[model samples]
Target: MKKNVLLILLFFCLTDAFAQIDIKRTTKDNDLKLSALPYYNYGKGLGITSPDSIFQFNIRFRIQNRATYMQEEGEEAAIDGQVRRLRLRFDGYVGDPRFIYAIQLSFAPGDVGEIKEGENLNIIRDAVIFYRPNKHWNIGFGQTKLPGNRQRVNSSGGLQLTDRTINNAKFNIDRDFGFQVHNQNEHPDKFSYNFRTAITTGEGRNSTDKPDNGLAYTGKVELYPFGSFTKDGAFFEGDLKRETTPKLMVSGAYQYNNKARRTGGQLGDDLFEKKDMKTTFLDAMMKYNGWAAMAAYMKRSAHDPITFNPNDATDIKYIFTGSGFDYQLSYLFPSNYEIIGRFSTQKVNRDIAALAPDTKEYSIGVTKYVWEHAFKAQMEFTLDDMTYLDNTSKQNWYIRFQVEMGI
Candidate 1:
């Protein structure tokens, strides 16, 4: 109890000191606005661990309404409010200067309003602690903001032109259960750099499964020389990345388990090694104005040299590498809005769908924003292509739409 109080006080003190300092725009607006993100879980969280894992995907779309609007007994869908997210965040500081905070909560389908078993989920999305110690440097702790893929980093509030993509379920939480430290003068879109690292228990929310050792490590950096200095220049309000902007981003992760315990059928505890499991993720985003492209690779499991190959092996044992790449493209329309698509193929060694290496995925999606701001909506038509190491494959499809809001 005392520890919790101290934590609360510490958070306030940091924000207080930072908020005491002043800024121009902040001199005007003041107040904690309403926050409501009420998106629908059109589909479930799918992966190799997901039921019917043959090229699985999770889809989200939701309805929303404000308390002011709900008071009249009006439904969110009545206003044609297909808001994927309805969380109103108060983006400001305390009285005066050095602080800034965007305290947020979950109100989505899988978040709030869910009474179903196995579907219950609620979390502090972004109760981050930050300090603008100065202009060039800022520090904070709490769930860290995403800094890998561009489409991934674009806040949900501003994603009116684009619907939420199908990734988070198998990717990053967009939030981590840990602390963060960031350094940047401003929100540098192009040619900016980010360094994020966290020490989290591989267990996302297993509070009782406390450990003093197991931790997950993540690191990534993004640079868009054009995001800053474009043909229109950096200071220009509308200077979108019309020129050839080499948006290069790379990320990698490693997770280790200490005394980790997982149960498998017919497999004894001795047969299952507790060795720390490792996974690597890599992503790259690039664009030359109207033409944009991106790709990501995730390897949840890799072959261990000794167990992978045997000199006396009689049968041809096809060694597996884990989840493969997810690729995408962009076609800049006459309007600033861009059409997008994605392609993914994986050769997983384990699966609840059929057998190993039995899935391939191809997806096409589109999103367009009137301006460079995060305002966008997106939709995708995905074809789940499946395959078996023994020459087998399956095909399925899913359509998704997402309207996101964020500040």
Candidate 2:
């Protein structure tokens, strides 16, 4: 009953906000026209614009369906199929071009993950408001992706393969509720640069309570020595545009989570005791003509890895402290078909190697882009090898196919 009431109130609040836009214009002496109905475009989604141009909104949704088959050495093959992702996104300027808002919601079970009691449903992926006072500066508040690794910051829909590498799953700072400041500038025919910083709650997104008085701080900077890529290609995987000139971007980021309660800092299960965690990331991306390449290195550490339960010393959990490397190469053909290859390796600290073993993965994939990333089909094959703490080794082979479409 309470949830229903809250939903009703939210609906009314949104209706009122939309109505207030016209009400304010009616009281003024400015010329105002009726807003047009929503219209759809191929990649831009459905958009609605106010006659006075004071407000604009765009609604977009994407769905990803995937099937996977995997076999371990001396084990039976396993097959799985599911809706990998079902996401709805809304973004636009609220009152003026400088004031922008973005909201994204996830519906697929895999996208929502495991929801704990007393916490949110974990469906809200991003809900951020931005103040772009100028072309070079943007200030944002609310839940969003942190200033982390390049691949982690990139939208999942823009990947060249089926998904990200193991390095990202192990070391990337995914997202959190935070305040971010970003700045970007470019010198014509020379170079470009971007700087971003954030301060956030140490807990990951959708947490109902704060486990401790801790926070996370992150800062990142990127430099492009050969000018910027065509159409913000730095943020997405692959080089679909086939840049006429060579483009390269190098980035570095550092994050410190003071007294974080989660095992993975902003991710993983809750730890019995809080610990300070620090992470560093270095990465670079290069694109020339139809070819693109990327490489990243990540390392993380904690003051103390293991945490023991206060009442029961036998129960324990440890932070994953380790290093990882990921590399990728891809080429986009004029026919809108692309081929990609990737190699990734991760090594956990010996103390936690039992829980998170050393791993290496090799993957190759092909993607057919009907309309760039918005409408695409992907197929990938991967070989995964892991070394356990006991010196035992295991290997697996995986084959996956996925289809993604939006707008």
Candidate 3:
């Protein structure tokens, strides 16, 4: 089944690429250049260049197909597979390079709304516009990924392994509708720095409106001692780009959501009622030669950890206040293959530790980068252990394989 899905996805990608029409036509006031290119800065897509540099657009899409096998302490091994992601993206600029816009649509079943009996494509991943006044400042508006954590912001297609750490699923702020400001200061002789801040509706992505009465405020700062990364490679795993010099970046972020409706901050389902929440993040990335390493820590808190309703026997679930950490290391070989290892641990508060088990996970994987991250095959084995407050323990092992095609 996985193979069939992969074959079908590949066929569609190829058909789309071959169906490209090359045209270089000029109008009275505008000249247009459109080409069907296999791989460029934006993957497999149509590239357009407008006359007089007034307007430009690129259309591209990608798909991720995966299969997995897992076994828990006393259960039979389970096998499962599905299409993980199917995304189509559009990006362009108008008049000046400073004015840029992007929109991404998701067709995957998991990414869209829950269908009663069938599937519905609830698209729209990123619909944002950016205005850069100068080299140091940029302003943006709309829905997009928040500057929450390194792993969360990194594109899934660019991961070194088959999947991200479990900590990200529980702690990272996925996306939201907001206004953002970015500032970067570069000094060839001194260390460079970058800063970001945002104000957004407390609700997560695709939320039509803010029913909660409060908003979310987020801020982040980063420092690079050995200058900056090549094409923002710090966000990606592995040393596939192979930096010549040793580069390092350290960052810290904080977010506060007043009257947040979701139990998992901005990523999970709505809670019984709103609660004020706060989260902190710290991360570091370093790469030298063919070796790369990353470490991150996350902690969450709420003003009211737990609440109850006197009217009914049921009460709002307690905020899963906790902490999580992840560490990753990888080495890239000249043959375009990478070996990676990851360790992650999560701990819940004492109040809910009995109900919510503490978790520890270890993963090792290898990736063959066909063309960087645009086209790759990856496989990994993971060992997950959970410890309950009663001292009981459960273990699970997972083996997974995935193919990523971004064109």
Once fitted onto the true fold, the runs of candidate 1 whose alpha carbons sit more than 4 angstroms away are: 1-84, 111-123, 145-168, 171-174, 184-192, 205-212, 223-275, 302-321, 350-357, 368-379, 401-407
Cα lDDT of all candidates, in order?
A: 0.45, 0.89, 0.85
Weakest 10 consecutive residues of candidate 3 by summed lDDT:
35-44
Model 3 TM-score?
A: 0.86
Q: What residue runs in model 2 are displaced by over 4 Å at the alpha carbon?
A: 1-43
Candidate 2 on 202-311: residue-level lDDT in tens? 78887767555789999999999988888888878888888888999999999999988788888888899889999999999999889999999999998769999999
TM-score of each: 0.58, 0.89, 0.86
List CA RMSD, all candidates. Answer: 15.8, 8.7, 11.0
What C-alpha lDDT does candidate 1 achieve relative to the native structure?
0.45
Clashes of each: 47, 0, 1
lDDT, candidate 1, 1-407, per-residue tens: 99999999999998997676443333357633222212223211211112222222222222332221111112232222333345533333454346655555656553344354543254455665567777655666555443433444555443322333333223332444555555542233645654555555444431233354655554555444434344322221122465454544444444433333221100112112233444455666554556656667765442331121245544222213355667766666667666666666666555322334445656666665643443445665656665666676555555656543232
Q: Which is the leading candidate under TM-score?
A: 2
> Candidate 3 lDDT, tens digit per residue, 1-407?
99999999999998887677665676875866455433234335776765446777899888999999999999999998988899999988888889999899998886775754442235778999999989999899999989988998899988888778878877888788889999988654358999999999978877654475699999999999988887778778888778888889899999999888777766665577789989999999998889999999998887657656556656656677889999999999999889999999999877667568899999999999998888999999999999999899999998999999987
Using lDDT as the measure, the top candidate is 2
Clashes of 1: 47
